[model samples]
Target: MFEWPWKDIARECELYLGPAGFSAVQVSPPHEHIVWEKHPWWERYQVASYKIESRSGNEAEFADMVKRCRRAGVDIYADAVINHMTGIPGGTAVGGTSFTHYDYPGIYDFNDFHHCGRNGNDDIVNYKDLYELQNCELVDLADLATETSKVQNTIAAYLNHLLDLGVAGFRIDAAKHIPAKDLKAIMSQLKRSAYVYQEVIYDPAGPISYADYTPIGDVTAYDYAHRLGAAIKDKKMDGLLHIGENFPASNDSIVFVTNHDLERTGDPYILKYSSEDQKLYRLAQIFMLAWPFGYPQVYTGYDFTNYDDGPPLNEQLRTLPVLSSQNQCTAPFTCEHRLPEVAAMVDFRNQTDGSFVVNNFWSNNTDQLAFSRGQKGFVAINFSGNQLPKEFQTGLPAGKYCNIVGASYNPNTHSCPNMIEVNAQGKANVVIQAYSAMVLLNRTTASQKKKAL
Candidate 1:
């Protein structure tokens, strides 16, 4: 639910994403920030105050949304923007709070922020210098002195407030710019344990490394996206056999196909959410969900022509409702998670949670690939232009399983619109169409339902 307002996210969790088997959602930064006239999306990342108010919602609305979403079995992981303050020198925040450089009223003062006098303007100009990168400003944003006790306490208090409101975790934004020691100090100040994942974009040449943060919590494995995007674009499915290699440990990585940033970059290395590349992008998501890799997250955000353009906003610049009419996500909202194929695969991932071993792996040496999750589930992807018609070892118990990706399966009614039959030898001869996928789950194994021809 990228860039979705708090209230809309709450409604969708109870109505759709929760029932659809989604575990958690990474939401936009809940902290107050500069309310630029243009209302660009990146403005949300530039924090003004610790108060939980923004284009998303006010404090009361955010609290209620968190409570409702948690009750629906969906946890809320807020994107905590503790790395820096407002990029602008002085401005009124979204909550109407006034603040100037290093002088947030009742929050931070001049001494609280870092004045790393390295570059002429104290801005981060050298990525190779770890000290300047950590202490200096990022894109003219006021860098917090996270190492000091006062600053760490203030940051911890803000996070503790969210935790009190039932937040499940935090996505430490700009984590690469903050020293690992400073982050650990802030985490220690928290009253209780919460899931923490850092945004340490993998950079082998840089002074700081993803490994530095792995000891603290899971780090984003951006290389996975780079490798995956390039492979999919090249129609080289076989190369993905070693997808997670040379990255963070599987248990300590958070992975996704395309996030808000990558989707807007127009980067050919990874697929974006667009009409022209929707098929391949969807196919890549299917593979990511099925394959045993890092903890997977399905990104669903609004479509934007300009990178700076924010989500659909009302006259007041507040985010509009996600869906348009008839509960269907229309223009501006890509709603990738709501897609039947992606939703079914969420169930696929959940059902095959413990089946980490990737067995019965088969590939056409080109664009077609099939693999099984230790008899729990099997997925076959056909990326080529031609329909892939062949028999493959599925490694599931012999039975008629529903093709959950293409159709629906009602367990109570024992109805599956589309079915794939497996013989006693645990193999199914299936024809997967071009740019489509076939997913079979043990839970979807239908015995009483009449088999499809």
Candidate 2:
């Protein structure tokens, strides 16, 4: 969600994208934050209090947005930043809430935090680095002492409020910094109203294991994002096959191409590195959405030359409106989610309902990758330099079907930009273009086993 009030935006989202299958909208942090006149946009991550008042909107507007989104069958997920509070000192938040370092009378003070500093670094001196990360300052921000009963109550109350508002889940920012035990405590306190996903960027070899966060909720599969991006950039089609193969079978993860923080912090490894390779980047996203492993998050970004620059804003510093009427993005927005192939993948995932990836996977070892979602749906991707001939195993019921990824289907003639007629043997001869993806659904008939010969 943007910084502006969500009433109108949520309403419009429901109007346009809702029909296109957007079941959820992840809003920015809804807490109050210390607003700096010089860099107002930085206020997003800096938390002052758990109150539902900030650049996004006030309490009433937030409630209204939730109601409207839920009414449209879309759920709201909050970006919960419980790791730290505002970094600036001697200043009230935009909501006029006052706070001080080592002395938060309204909540708790620094003494209430877990203090264990090897050096005299007041910034974070405590739970053996883990405690400080959770209870001390993060980038000079006032860290919440989640270990304390008072702090836990406050955080729990705030989360409960959002849950009561009918949010679907949460995205815990900087979760790797926070201790797993404290996170479990916080999770135990909540009324189980929403799902909790922690941000643990685990590489191939990391100090922390994803299993730590799995006890609480799903951990972000940051490695998957990096690997996918790398494969796309190198044009290493074979490397792309290794995607999701590395993910631990036991733990669930949230996979995404990019997020607000990564895009803002200029993570060269992901987007910046793949800047010159747009086709590959898009193909990586397609494969991610096609393969069933973790919960997939599709990013809709605004084009920016500078990484630190905020979303398209007006002179007043408020986020400018996003135009989705033309099925295209304008005014510096990189609406990758609107692409026909990407949108089709979302639809495919929704239709698959997290089924196992059928092992009958086929790849040309060059550009084409095809797989079936058990018997529900079939997908073929063409990433080669040239168009592919009409040939592939779709694993669908024997019948004629329309390609949902191409042009919209006309109910009258049932004509679409792409069509396939599956033979009695449950195979489809699919032709796809370079840098394109095709998905076919067996909406007409169910996949039944062949009779014993």
Candidate 3:
């Protein structure tokens, strides 16, 4: 979730993008946080109270954004940061909520935290070491002992309040830091009201497996991002064919190229560490969106020279507004989510919902990748700096259909660079540009006719 003034930006999103097919807008934490004079935006993750009084907006404004977004057929998913609280010095939250090092009268005092000196330093590592992760400080942020009934109820109340306000789900932050059982308890309390997506950065060598958090909710597939990033850089389209084959088909995973923490820490996967690397990063994102794997999240970021630099904000310490025009963003704001290729994939994914990826996959072993989605949608990618001319099975009922990638008619005509038409024989002679992707929609499906009716 990108943190901005929701009251102002949410409406624009609802009007322009929401109804077009966006199911939800993942909002940053609505909870109160510790405001720092030097880095006020750091408070976004350093939660103080569950009260809805932060930079995004007040409780009323939040409710309005929810109602408006829901009215536009868009749901809201909140980024729930329950792992720790304020760690910076002399930073009080905007809602008048305050917490000192290891001391929070409203929540829990700091001494209650664990101080195990392990990894050659005092830090939490795993569930078996629950006391340290839950109670000990996370990078100096006041950790909360979620195992306590009081803390559980407090957090539950906060989550339930959002549910009552119409939020559809949550992305649990620092989930691996908490015990699995404690997370299960918290989720059990949440019940069916909000969908939970846990953040457990996968490290196979580590004690925690994704299964630990799966019982509570969907776990993020960090490995997927790593693999996709590598394959794209290598220009190994055959490797792209292997995408999503690694994860169990039964589990729901949150797939993302870059996130708040990754972008904040200057994760090399994004920000064009090199020109070639930047193109590969964009290609990986396109591939991720095209493939039928996990619940995908698109990242919208801002330009930054330093890892610690925050979102573009005004002198008042509020985040700047987002610009909605195509290929243009507010200065310093990089709205990759609105890019033509990225936005096109959103439509392609939504249109092919409930479709499975068919197996007759093919790739040039270097720069071209092609596959069909359960006879419903077909896609081809070309990245070899040469036009791809190939005939592939589309699995569609014979009819002339507009290629969704090249010429989608929804937003407007000539909106995209390439447009191909598939004939009645379910065959397409695709000629794709070196750095582009093409997707074809099966036009004669029963669902399509039913929708037409």
Candidate 4:
């Protein structure tokens, strides 16, 4: 969700996301931006000014949302757009502020932007050239002259202002366009330490590399999403066994199955929230959460027929609320994260956080894959259409554990209706349904719920 609607959604974080064990919520960009007629989602990325006001609501609403969500044990990560200003020649922003391609009222002047002398026009044409890609305008947007001290300070000030509002971190939007040293300089000027992740889309053959930005902060693991999506689609479990091979070190990467951009790319390798691939998408997310990987972020947003279509809007053109009826997500709002299975996997991730090493890995040489988190947790995934019934080495203690994918343990009653009993020999006879997963965690409420009779 975007615009003022996210405020109401943030209020519901306490009631829903907090108990679900989500660590943070990455809200849409809070900065003022250009006002498009149809209100395309990309408009939010084309910033007008650094002021904490936009279609997403005024500064007061943003502040209140931060405070409320923080109190619920969920940190707020703002999507900071610092690489450029409005792509439009002239327009009034959602904040009622006026701006042109090279100027934003009191903030940036024509001199503050880069009119990079590139191929014919100033726009980026050669992605293989690092210099042009860094200096040239992206999609006609006025690129920021970040090499200058004044520009670095300006960017830092915007981030510092967000930190002052109790914002826990930032998703550095379009970070690949900005030079790594410039980003390091800007990040160094922050008044306080903040969690930072740069969006450096991985391109193996590209001149710019994600490794260049990892020294400053975690970089988005695009390769993970790309490879995992392909593996799932092809039903090749072996490809994912060493998924992080060429990617950044696990600690320096922020991984996800899909994000706002990749989901809209219409790329076959990238999975999106849709009726056709819903089951497979959820299964992939379950595998990502269960497997030890980079900090995994789950994406949940609205459905769109057209790539440029924005979130559902009101008569005022502001975004409409992502409401629910009878505990089911309403139209236009997919709310994929709130799905029972995805929510259960969140708990699976939470319970097995520190157990990073993948132990006792097993597969049927194909679609059926199973692994354990050093005895802390175990998972079995069946991507094939046929049911997977097998006696395998579970690597868990003898106990009756809840199959969290289907049903969760009721700690209050110390019972789990859907239980799988592991024998004393650290083995179990289990069956996993087609295109589904089964997760069991040791040293958890489910493990202690009851003993195997």
Candidate 5:
């Protein structure tokens, strides 16, 4: 969640994240990388060596974190930038490894990289050219020759190192640039089968198709965020009640509202947890979590006023620790997952596992929507202004239900700090505020005294 080292994250696993019901934590790239003057986050994406040494922490610390999170029942998903090498010609890595472009000491040699610059070509100008896009350099990063046995061995060995360290999976950076067959080949050689998600940016008209990658692992549904955010931004939520409506299959997709890339790459349709859009962004998150769509990933990172700005750092280039504000998240960090409602929603998902949306209802104006996941849970969302007072089929057993979004379920009291009563007819007279949502969990009587305070 927070942009901190593995050690810092380990300390909070049991106390903060584990209790919140997080399945995994996707960390920044841990490979040794070309160190820049300011140590930008993208620089971590540029590889120097497979050594588990970088700005985040050393080998021992990384190992300790994996062990700690496992005990807490949270897996670590390391961001593996195996697509290319550093864009620079020569530089020293943050871990003290020294190397130049396409030449890492004791690893790859010059021939291991693709010299795609035919006419001194250094950039990708033809988005329509399939061969150029796959074989050529992306933003000048030296493309690896993954088809060769030597390159495949080195890549697999690197990932095996992480698997040996207890990493649960990998987020293959720039996965679209690598052929699916080559990727599958590398993964097949891992020490053990590991969960894998490829960073394949979706472009429907682009040469690369997600079909090639889904057989391997989940593909990033960038289109999900782009399209969903657009719908919510335009105050249209009725059409999105159906999960996987405009996205890849539920099991093959990984959905998110914003990530490191989208926050900086300004697109009006996409969203960031900004002052004006924070509420709306949270609504999108609710929809994602409530709906039975692809695996959902909630992003919580550094707050940046400038698109190029990296996480808060000291003069020594070390990341500053993030603190909680007792509200939704801490300052300078969009800790959306830490919000009481969001955390409760994580539990909401777990309680209603194997459930599908039923008893679906959409308002006449289409701005208000309600649905049930099986008979265990119900959710109502109001996207328009003013209070919305309407009765809808909840599909849940009748009781004094707690609004997980607005209140907390106090187990000791066996009552909600804030309660919304539902009748035996499976109806709730829900009145949600503008751009707000309510979630009801019948598995247990939710109460605000336990969490909503």
Candidate 6:
């Protein structure tokens, strides 16, 4: 699913992302980053300038993509890498911009960066001290003195330019590295209310806290990921009934199963699609999409055994065109967005929006879960290794509804490849197999099913 040149991603917004009911596409850092050998993915994180020209495309091309995607009813969430500059000593960046470590021309100079110690060379070796986490270089990457007004203005300008280009929001990368005061100042200066999601890996033992950043924007729910990962990995579907139990409430979280950083690089917290726990990974996505929780994000990228493997590309290192056919997957790219279950859940989520979960059904076995999002929809997921057969009170009027999960829905015919019937009493006998999900939608009436579909 690797599509470079902002133009290609825009096209995907229409074909794949938009059609799949996704509201936005979280893109890589558009800024000019340190170009590395073989075009590793992290090179984009090591930014030299805020110019929108890197492996993806140039400024004009990026602007055009933004316009096109907006027309397609999909928004763009750009990864803002403002925490630090290239970890490696800089040269001319991918966009032909000249730079040196801690000294970006016309942008940042030696005084702009920080050092944990007075020497301006200390790496982050401790998390106990708040200053060390906020002021020190993260993983040897040159840290920015974001508290300074000069730095705040520069970052604001960079972000505002993206706003002018019609970007919906930003995912502040490595936000924990910058102090909360500095982040507040930078966000306050932005002219528009761009949707902000900060990347602060929550830690109870760490000096910085997630609560301080939640006032600014949604914080990445790593705690949710860890709990969900454990539940799925241990086959404890019962544990997932209260998935968002301790999270920062439903409104203040960007819940996801796994992200680019967690799936790759050092300190992976979950098994990726390439590993033996692939089924659990996929199942986790299903639960996230179905359950009425925080805004859900479905991650689909190139599959790799190695952590440093970049996007799928041709001989020129230019990314290959994203294709629709599964057969076209040259590399091990796990395009989970295209899965039938995932797509159907998107429909389920929309139909059940603003509806709360009720009529829960689970027992001691707890391998099976059945719940309704008010009367609008009903869903049952069976995560046990064996097939399950059970009857539950669906809480819907007598009608025939299509099972969107195990089968496809035909809006034109108002028919389902497979259908389920709820009797007059709102009781339905549901049979689900291992690692499978079933959905019955009430809003999808015979006449309006097309709209829901």
Q: Flag regions of model 3 displaced more than 4 Å.
A: 117-121, 125-135, 245-251, 264-279, 324-328, 407-425, 446-453
Candidate 6: residue pairs that collide: 5-56
* Residue 385 local lDDT, model 2: 76
1-453, model 5: which lDDT tens digit per residue? 535667767866766777777888888888887767656668778899999887677889889999998898788999999989889988878777889887887999999987776537656667667777778888888899888889999999999999999999999999988888999899889988888998988677888888889989988888788777766766566557543665568777888888888877768877878657787788877877877777789887877776556677666555665654332344676566666677777777767765744566665434667788867889888766768788878887888877877745653243576688889988888678877888888865332211100
Task: Order the candidates by TM-score, highest first.
Answer: 1, 4, 5, 6, 3, 2
TM-score of each: 0.95, 0.86, 0.88, 0.95, 0.93, 0.92
The Cα error of candidate 1 at residue 225, in Å, is 1.5
Whole-model lDDT per candidate: 0.83, 0.68, 0.68, 0.80, 0.77, 0.76
Alpha-carbon lDDT of model 5: 0.77
Q: Model 3 Cα displacement at 69 (Å)?
A: 0.7
Better model by TM-score: candidate 4 vs candidate 6: 4
Cα deviation of 91 in candidate 4 (Å)?
Answer: 0.7
* Consecutive 10-residue window with the lowest summed lDDT within model 1: 444-453
Judge candidate 6 at residue 300 and give its lDDT: 74
lDDT pick, better of 2 and 4? 4
**Residue-wise C-alpha lDDT for candidate 1, range 399-444, written one tens digit per residue:** 8888877756663343587788999999999888888888888864
Q: Could you report the Cα RMSD, in angstroms, for every candidate shown?
A: 4.0, 5.0, 3.9, 3.7, 3.7, 3.2
Residue ranges of candidate 2 with Cα displaced over 4 Å: 2-5, 37-41, 114-136, 203-206, 248-251, 265-276, 312-317, 323-330, 408-418, 445-453
Provide the lowest-lDDT 10-residue window in model 2.
444-453
lDDT of 4 by residue, 1-453 (tens): 333265665666777777777888888898888888788989889888888876667888889888988888788888899999888889888778887888776788989989889877799998888888899988898899999998999899999999999998898988999999999999999889888998887677888887789988988888788888888787788888989888888878888888878888867978766857777788888898888778888888777888898877667556766665444556787777777777677777777766777988888656789998877888999888899999878888888887777756563343577788999998989888888888887865332210000
lDDT string, candidate 2, 1-453, tens digits: 444346544764566445556667777888887667654456788877778887667788888888887787677889898877767765777678887755555766766555445346546544244444455566676666676777778788889899987777888988877778878888788887577888886644554677778888877877776676666555566776567775655237777777766656644547531267577667767777777677787776566665455565456444566655553446666666666666566656666764556645877665677788877888787777788876667777787788766657543354586567889888776668777777777655333221000
* Runs in model 5 lying further than 4 Å from the true structure: 323-331, 364-366, 408-414, 444-453
